[model samples]
Each structure stands twice: as structure tokens, then as C-alpha cells.
Target: MDQNEIQFSYRARDDRGVFEVVPRVDGTPLTDLIDKFETDAGMRPSGDAYGGLVPQFFRFGPMEDHFHGRLGDAKTPLLGCECGEWGCWPLLARITTTDDLVIWDAFEQPHRPARDYTGFGPFRFDRHRYDDALGKLSRAVDEGS
Candidate 1:
């Protein structure tokens, strides 16, 4: 199967004084991608209710036992509420990694379990490239840029 390229970029809302790093898949914002899927599925767009998680939570890799509670086995919180509280609204996905690939699939809206996100993604990425993008994000965060 073909893989999607993943990249991380920062967005700053000067009016709200909010700065965050957002994930982009295949050159489009991941949020927009999800919105497109929801729209196509005849569901209401999530709009501003959700946003990317804070930089610190992006520890992308194989699923582990350490991920419990709101993040069940193989799942990680990818996007969270714009209000800065993750539990309020989150877009979670099962993330699994192989030696050369990272896969994100089985998306869920914990707050709205009835909403099915079955066809949204099973996005695959080259491990090396994904790691490089993550490294860039880490450096940018450390530099406060």
C-alpha cells in the first residue's frame, strides 16, 4: 500500500496568544483532512472544537503498556480541544510502528463514540522521515519558535 507523508508545522494565533505544533499529512493540515472525511461521511465538521495536541504529547511510536486511561492500548491522543484541555474533546488513533514504518489507524472521538471514523485513515509513513519531522518539531519547541 502507498504511504502518506507526515510533517509537523507550528501555528500561532496572535490574537489568542496561542502557539501550537500541528501535524500535516501529505501537505495538508491533519485537522482539515479529518474535516474532509467527516464532511464526506455526512457528519458535521468538528470546526474549532478540536485542535492539535501540545508538542509534548507527540511521542509517536509503537503502542505500549504505559498508554492507559483515556489512551487505551495502541491509542494516542492526536488532537485535543481548542480550550487547551485534552479531555474535553480529543481525536485519538491507534498508532503502531514497525522497524521501517509507522501506522495510524482506527480513529475515534472519545467524547462522541457513536460517530464512526472507520474510513478516515490508516495512514502510513516512512519511519526515518517521520522521525526527522519529529526532531525538527522538538528543536523548534526547544528554541521557543
Candidate 2:
């Protein structure tokens, strides 16, 4: 989802360099980022949808658990709600450090002209573990069949 006014890149490992928890001011709104996370990445909310758990553009715990269970490793850079709740709150996240830090970028609602928030280092993950998980995620996104 490349736009003339915005640029997007991500590094799931330590070398990816996600040091700060600030919004990218390249003229792209937060909702567009979340849309990429959902449409391009295929990350969806994983609870009972009829129970008020709709598919979220950015879901932390479920994505973490999915990768963790498959890889049998615990190192990941992406972190989510500390209280373990799921919703379309986080717009995007990046691993700041190898395994003990991440910057969670979020928005109050998935709309423009809305309040936004940033969280620094909420979840921890190992670099290699993150790599493995990312590989799987990328494959899932690329090979949707």
C-alpha cells in the first residue's frame, strides 16, 4: 500500500530498528496502516465474533499466540494489551530491540481526526524467535491459498 505522501517499512528483528513510538508523519493516517495490517497481512481478531469480538485490524495477543504455538519459541518483538484484551485499537507496532522492547503505536479509534496513543516496550521477544515468527507470517500473507 504505497502512497505518494507516505512510506512504510518494518523490521521484525533487532536490526529492523524500531526505536521510538511515534507516528510516521509522512501524511499517511493511522487507519491506513491498520488496514494494511488487516488486508495485506491477514491478521484478524480471533474470538467469537458474535460475542462482540469482531475482526480487528491490529490484534496483539492472538497473533503472538499463533506464532508462538507454531514455532514453540517465546521470543517476539510485537506486544499487545497488557490486560490481554483484543480490539481494533493498535494501528501498528515494531520491534525496537531484539527481545525485550517494542513500540506499540495505537489510535483511539480507526478513523481520522481521532485521538492517538503510543506505548513503548510493552512486550518482549527474542530476535531469532521473532524472525521465525515473521517468516511464518510473511508466508501466510504471500501464500494465501
Candidate 3:
């Protein structure tokens, strides 16, 4: 999530009682921009405690299920994974109830260096950012406006 990077904001609906996160980046009109605060963090392999460089990206990175308390909470929502694909670069996703499309400035995610292939298993995505998002949602709920 970068201020200069253009991202397509989308809200997922309960398609058959499931939250399907679909990215909408192409074919969208533009206008005066709004400021939205969304964030993400990445991981790179480090040592030989687990696996290797993970040669293949997961099919789906971390994402929200669009249910329960919020995207991140005690819920511990997973990040979108790029399953064994060439162009499967990890991404930051926003999970919403309605399909409200909006593009705005967001917090740039942390830069994670590629992990050293030392067979240290797979790298784990950061939890602090996710926890913060959940915290924001909780605060919104607490305000009770």
C-alpha cells in the first residue's frame, strides 16, 4: 500500500455465504481522490530452521473471510497467498461487506528482504499490522455511532 501506487478498492459480498476477495484494478474511472488508511507487511525467508526460499508463491496470499468481528481480530485472518505462480506477487487486500469502490492514499507496507535459502521452513507473514487493523475495527465498533 503506497501513496503513489494505484490500487483498486473493492468490497466483497457474501457470494453463497462466503467472502470472495476479488481485486478490481483495471477499467475503473477516476475523480477527486480520497485518503484511505490501509496497510500490509511482507516476509522473506531467513535461515535453515524450516524450508527453502519457497521457490513457489502460494495460490492465495493472506485475506479476510468477511465475517465475524473484522478482517483482523482475535479472528486471526490469514493473508492472501500466491499459489505456485510466476506473476503471483504478494499483495495487500481489503475485505468489506459491501462493494464500495474507492481509491486513496494508504500507508506503505514494510519492505521485507528476500529470505536466505537456509532451509529454515517458510517465512510467516507479520501479525502486528493485522492486529492493528482488527484493533481499528474494534474501536469503530466501540464508538457505537
Candidate 4:
């Protein structure tokens, strides 16, 4: 598998008996990856962040201008607070798309600008495959609802 390849899977959870679907990337929980990055960088990992892959807010497109936004730019929220609120703790990244590829880079921890995420990712994915993965996830979520 290519290092830049992106894949998505769900990590089901029982939150006080209420089932929740958290997304996983390349078979590893998204939050775990963030934690690992922090640890590797000699920083204490905050184990409270959670993946927030809600279809509406996370679909492949330009995000609503928030922390780092321009009038009609693209950005995506990858993770949110464990308390289930996205704005409280978000791990955002700029998503740039081309004819045959989708690139995720310029990561930011909105609330902690001082913390650098320079080496975390610049994950690139083939556009067709990326769309397929997201489409599958959307269908699964719709079916479950």
C-alpha cells in the first residue's frame, strides 16, 4: 500500500448504549494517529479527541469558512472533541483537489495555533478511489439511519 493512500473504515462505539460510528483511516483510528504524532514529536498527546466523520459536515467539498478560510476555499474537519462537539476541538486540514487527485495538507489545531503539525500529513489520494471510499461510507451511514 502506498504511504499516501487514504482509506476509511468505521470504528463502532457504544456511548452509554447509544451506538456511534467513528471513522478509521487505513485501519487505524484517526485519533490514534494524532496521538502517535504528538508522542513522536515529544509532546503529550491529548487522548480526548475523537473522529467526527458526519457526512454532511465532512463530505468532499469546500468547507464553511472557519478557522482558516477564504471566501470559497476548501478545508475539512478530521477530528473533534470527545464530548461530541466539533468546534470545541477540531483538527482541520486544507483539502486541495485536482483532475486526478485529492490532497490533504496544511493541518491545524484551531485552538492551539502554536502547536505545529508540519509533518503529520500531506496525504494524497487518487480522486476516483477517494470518491469511492467516501461514497461507500455515505451509503452505509444512510442505511444505518
Give the winner by lDDT. Answer: 1
Best by TM-score: 1
**Which pairs clash in model 2?**
75-126, 76-125, 76-126, 99-125
Write the residue-wise lDDT of candidate 4 on 1-145 in tens digits. 2435555554444553322335455666667888788777776546655555443433333222221234354566767766545677877888776678777688888788888999987777777877777676556666655
TM per candidate comes to 0.81, 0.27, 0.21, 0.75
Clashes of 2: 4
Lowest-sum lDDT 10-residue window in model 4: 60-69
On TM-score, the stronger of 2 and 4 is: 4
lDDT score of model 2? 0.31
Root-mean-square deviation (CA) per prediction: 4.3, 16.6, 15.4, 4.6
Please list the residue runs of candidate 4 whose C-alpha ends up more than 4 Å from where it truly belongs after superposition. Answer: 1-3, 16-23, 54-74
lDDT (Cα, tens digit) per residue for candidate 2, span 30-104: 334444534443335422211111113233334334333332433322222222222323232332443532223
Worst 10 residues of 3 by lDDT: 31-40
Query: 40 in model 3: Cα distance from truth in Å?
Result: 19
What C-alpha lDDT values do all the predictions have?
0.70, 0.31, 0.24, 0.61
